[model samples]
Target: MVKGYSNHEEQVFTKIAELRTSNYDSKSINDKIAENQNFSGIIGSLNLTVENYPELKANEEYKRLSENLVIIEDEIALSRKYYNGTIRDYQKFTQMFPNNLLAKLLKSPEFLMFEISENEKENIKI
Candidate 1:
């Protein structure tokens, strides 16, 4: 039972880590497109496992890592929601009339609201 539980935890954590890396990748691409330096590669490394690691995915440790990753992914999603909400609010405030005037006077750059695709919107839960 201990082994099973640990495996599950590892899997969840691994999934969460994967999701984080993916989000970082998305942000990196966005930054690159916005003329900023891409930094996603600094977070993690990737490769073709068959050629590089040779059946690493089939190993028990790797399986446990993958399972644990899923649980971690939920926490990441929550964190992202909080950040997205904050960014959205900042953007909205910057667009308001008096706030817009104040922002202009302060030379404040507008916050970029995070964009979610239609598929993401459709998948959102209350």
Candidate 2:
């Protein structure tokens, strides 16, 4: 599980770096990351392995790492939720009466929400 996760993470980071070097915008880069099947599969596989292996689950190091991962994941989710909320508010503000005229004159770029695919919506076993 660790090997799979590490390899998938490396690949994702490499791809993101490459995309950034190629001048992809942040939203496009984020979309590419969200659509990465290998990364998603690795996460799913790790979750399954943990669920299936009682011994692994019982290991002190594994438990510690798992708890840390859970906390990090929750924090990331919260951050994403907060970011999306801010984007929504900004979009609404831009579309409102006086702000609409200013936005039109400035031609502001639309904010993209950090979205997860349907498969990502499933809870991880851990």
Question: Which prediction has the highest TM-score against the true structure?
Answer: 2
Task: Residues 38-111, candidate 1: write the lDDT tens digits.
Answer: 22121122212212444655678766855664565466567657867887888789889999999889997655
Worst window of 10 by summed lDDT in candidate 1: 36-45
Q: Write one digit per residue (lDDT tens) for candidate 2, span 36-84.
A: 4344455566667567556667779878977887887788689878988
For model 1, the superposed segments whose C-alpha errors exceed 4 Å read: 1-54, 113-126
**C-alpha RMSD of each candidate structure in angstroms:** 10.4, 4.9
Best by lDDT: 2
Instruction: List TM-score per model, in order.
Output: 0.46, 0.64
For candidate 1, report its TM-score. 0.46
